[model samples]
Target: MRRLLAGLISLFCFTSSTYAAEVSVALAANFSAPMQKIAAAFEQDTGHKAVLSTGATGKFYAQIRHGAPFQLLLAADQTTPERLEREGLAVAGTRFTYAIGQLVLWSTEPGLVDAEGAVLRSERFTRIALADPKLAPYGAAALETLDKLGLRQQLQSKFVQGENIAQTYQFVASGNAPLGFVALSQVFADGRIREGSAWIVPAELHSPLLQDAVILKAGADNPAALALADYLRGEKARSIMQSYGYGF
Candidate 1:
């Protein structure tokens, strides 16, 4: 009887361990910092691991369409996730807004970008970086802002495009471009600037960047993936996102 009972207990442990699965997430580059904190909290609270892949939302969309193994997608915009759902790549009714991103014109050099963003009119810099509008929503917002200011044509020769917001920020931070448009969350934390200079772009300059999250069809039945999605909507994850300058 003792031997039989011990074998049954071992089987139960094995089954329980198998159920504690790891979820793979494709995350937008701009949300990388805050997502790290959220992923860690998710693992601790749920006993499930979250593995992250970060890059431009466009690239992620392409990869998912081609059958990438990611179980979830945290997109930089709402459109991509909706497309995935419509195409049957994502689980239906699982999409929700996760964050609203803010765009900013930033420079690693202090005081280079004025609060009013008059520096663009000054045309003092040789090169300005922005993400490729075709690939990054923040880049689209930057382009819209430039167009609204009537500077797109004037500054056409000075534009440098990065494939994603992370690379766009790198171009300015590394001095390859004197100024660049980036996600505000990248340079701001805890209600203060973390470095250099920045001008928060007026919201009216572009459409609202509503970020969304969805469960891919591959993870529709995965407990870990479901848990991570729920955790993202919880107080802890929301607080971390707020600290990183993201709005719901």
Candidate 2:
């Protein structure tokens, strides 16, 4: 009886492992932190793994166009996914908004940035970091904010551009630049700033950041990919996103 029970347990373990799936995902740089947690939870709950690669959405779009093998895309803006649908690179009707992101002007040093963000006019810092506007939605929003404040041209000379929002945050965190515009999720958690000082850029200052996710054509028949899409829309995933300061 003991030998028979051991055989049955081993067979069940093998069967479960055989059915577990892994889906490759392309994630926006800004959503990396929360997505990591979501991916873990997804595997635990569904017995499927999510393999994540994070980067600028625009770059991912170009890569997808050029035949990158990603099965899913979580973009920083809605337009990219919409475009993919138009271009027939993504599966039709699989797109949906997962989060609305906020932007912030942040510095590693405390008290350098005022509540009203008046530090932009003071010329106190020699350099400021931002992502490439052409490649990153957060970078474009940063430019829009400066333009709204009528400081774009004046601040352009002090600009240090990063490849993506993650790099932008790293610039401020490492003191390569005293401060920079970054995704609020990078510096915020649990309804407050996690570290350093930040002035949350108001939504009215720039266009709304409607982030969306979609399954790619390559994943149209992939069960794991489809499952992950459904998972992102579930309450558990939204709670994780909320903790990271993302809006539904």
Candidate 3:
């Protein structure tokens, strides 16, 4: 019994030291809810902590440019990561799209806006919230959908901007705004839309939301950073993401 106990102790110490590092991440707000799940699983499986910071993709770019100490970046769009790589801030050949996101016009109030977006034409609401188009990808999609339907100028006065997609969700969830555009992942449960009334914006309304992730140049030598990126592409992570309304 004593020998068995000693061996077990020896094994535990070896495993602990083997997976002791932490990986710092900059995650886009649209991905916050799912990333939380991924983070928990990642720590359990690898014993590497994931310290996450969530923000608008644009703002995160600014942070990286100014030396924010993030090891991995999961952006709502590919441009920022590509740009970072181009600017030599991220390691070359380490960039890839992690998930494809969808845009939705959502409201806590049922039937406020038809999923087809026909409600926007009626001008029934005094406020419509969205993230800043210059920041969040979902906001960009929202603006494009409105523009495609020629409601940009008509609804200009009612626009409320959030710093990121997460805040945009809060605007509607807290009734700060009656309706808003957000990532479909917000309302998705078990790979489907589970609650609230929403219009899954037609793809024709905007460009595809190809979210990307990459290892920053500052973390080029860190295996933990690469491992996190690899885990995102793994089956377990992909399953969790699918359950959250993201694709491939």
Candidate 4:
């Protein structure tokens, strides 16, 4: 009789309190698609709301540095979280690599980006798009990759910069540019390429992109915040990231 009573009480408490716990997360744009899927899965399994906000990691870092009321941060580069930890902006020892992103040269037009390394040499197209290196890690990689291939000098005049990765992808997706560099996750899915053609730039061309996440200091004591940090590294979350083409 006592066991039955305890079980009934536990159920009532869970049902009554679930609506009150909500976790607020600041997410990087490159991981937005996968994060959405993780949030949905988390809520379904835990009954804790995952409120995700997406933007460029660099911009988001600025916001958090300026004391934004965010509880969690998922950065596109590991350095951001390391700085946050050292500066006391985020909880120490909570940082870890959440994903490693791949940079791709993509074009909305079919065959616009030839994988044979001929497009850079052809000089037929006048415009190329990339995220601003100052605000995006992938953008920095893009620039470096071009330089490695000895095309930066030749391509400088035709470069179009986007403020963030999403905007960079949009520049090509919207037909604003013939080709562009963007996160592979944005252009590929389900073990196959998307509508457009792309070349997944090898990691040797640029620095490794090690995305990381940390809990903000202001959120250290909040249960929701703690849960969110934990959730990002969980098995279910990792699986979603893989679907978006991000690796550990």
Candidate 5:
């Protein structure tokens, strides 16, 4: 009886492992930190693994268009996912807003940026890092904020563009640029700034950054991909997103 029971248990374990699915996900650069935690929880709870690829949203969109074989997409802006849905690249009626991101002007040095963001007018710094406007929504928002402050043309010569928001954060954090526009989540932790100084850019300065997610057509028959999409909308994932300073 003991030997028979051991054989049954081993067969069950082997079957479960063999059937577990792995979903490929294309993620936005700004969502990296929180997605890591969420993906881990997903695997633990559902036994489905998520493989992530992070980069600028625009670049991801281009890759998806060129047959990138990704099963899911988490974009930095709503427009990209909406376009994919309209273009039939994504599954119909599966797109939804996952988070709203806040922009911040940050510097590695303490006291470099004030609450009012007066440092922009002072011209005390030589280089200001921003993501490439054409490829990153955060970079476009940075430009809009500068234009609102009437400093776009004046700061143009000093601007340094990065490939994505992650790279933009690295530029400032590494002191390559004294200051840069980045997602607040990148520098925030446990309800406060992680390090350095930051000026929280008011939402009125730019259009709302409503991030959206969608399951791709390639994942239409993938149960794991569908499960991941549903999991992202559940309370556990929502709590994790909130911890990262993302808004609903």
Candidate 6:
């Protein structure tokens, strides 16, 4: 009886392993938290694993152009995916908007940033952190907001640029900068800003941040890649995104 049970268990494990595969994905830094959670859930539900690499969309674009083995891309803006598709680096008709991101004016120090975002006008802080606008959608949005407020020229001198939004958040969190702009998803948790003070930058201040996802040509024949792409559009993934303050 013991031998029979052992045999059955081994067979089950073999079958599961035979059907499982890994999908390599390049993800936007701002979506790291939710995507991690979603990847775990996706693996649990589908028996496939997601191998994630997070960074600025522009960097990922450059890497993809250089033949990076990443099978999928979750970008910070629709333009990158669209451009990839146009360049024939990704599969056509597979691109879709996965989320709409929001920007925040954040400070690790409580009450340092007001709800109206009037802190940008103050000269109290010596340095302000933001991602490089050329590489990050969040950074571009930050510039647009500053421009609309007519503070771009005045505040440009205090800028401390990060390579990506994740690093930009780190700069402020580590006290390198007293305050700066970041993605709402970074500081958001439990239906509110997790710590410190933040003003959710109104969407009207800049162009809409439509984050898109696509399957790269390298993944065109990969079943795991297709599964992951479809899984991202499913209910479980949508719920995870919503928890992170992402919009559909």
Cα-based lDDT for every prediction = 0.94, 0.95, 0.91, 0.86, 0.94, 0.95
Error of 3 at 130 (Å): 0.5
Runs in model 1 deviating more than 4 A are 1-16
Model 4 C-alpha lDDT per residue in residues 17-119, reported as the tens digit of each score: 9544777788888888888888888878766777888878889889988988888888889888899899999999888888899999888777877786578
* TM-score, one value per model: 0.94, 0.96, 0.94, 0.91, 0.96, 0.96
Q: Write the per-residue lDDT of candidate 3 for residues 73-133, one digit (tens) a residue.
A: 9999999999999999999999999999999888988778786788888868899999999
Clashing pairs in 2: none
Can you write out model 1's per-residue Cα lDDT over 1-248, one digit (the tens) per residue? 99999999999989879877899999999999999999988888888999999999999999999989999999999999999999999999999998899999999899999999999999579999999999999999999999999999999899999999999999998999999999999999879878888899999999999999999999998999999999999999999999988988
Cα RMSD, each candidate? 2.3, 1.3, 1.8, 3.3, 1.3, 1.3
Per-residue error at 40 for model 2, in Å?
A: 0.8
Give the Cα error of residue 213 in candidate 5, in Å: 0.1
* Each candidate structure's count of clashing pairs: 0, 0, 0, 0, 0, 0
State the displacement of the C-alpha of residue 28, model 2, in Å, after optimal TM-score superposition: 0.2
**Compared to the true structure, candidate 5 yields what TM-score?**
0.96
In candidate 4, how many Å is residue 127 off? 1.0
Off by over 4 Å in 4: 1-15, 18-20
lDDT measured at residue 47 in model 4 versus the true structure, 0 to 100: 69
Among residues 3 or more apart in sequence or in different chains, the pairs in candidate 3 whose N, CA or C atoms overlap within 3 Å are none
TM-score of decoy 3: 0.94
Give the C-alpha miss distance for residue 154 in model 3, angstroms. Answer: 0.2
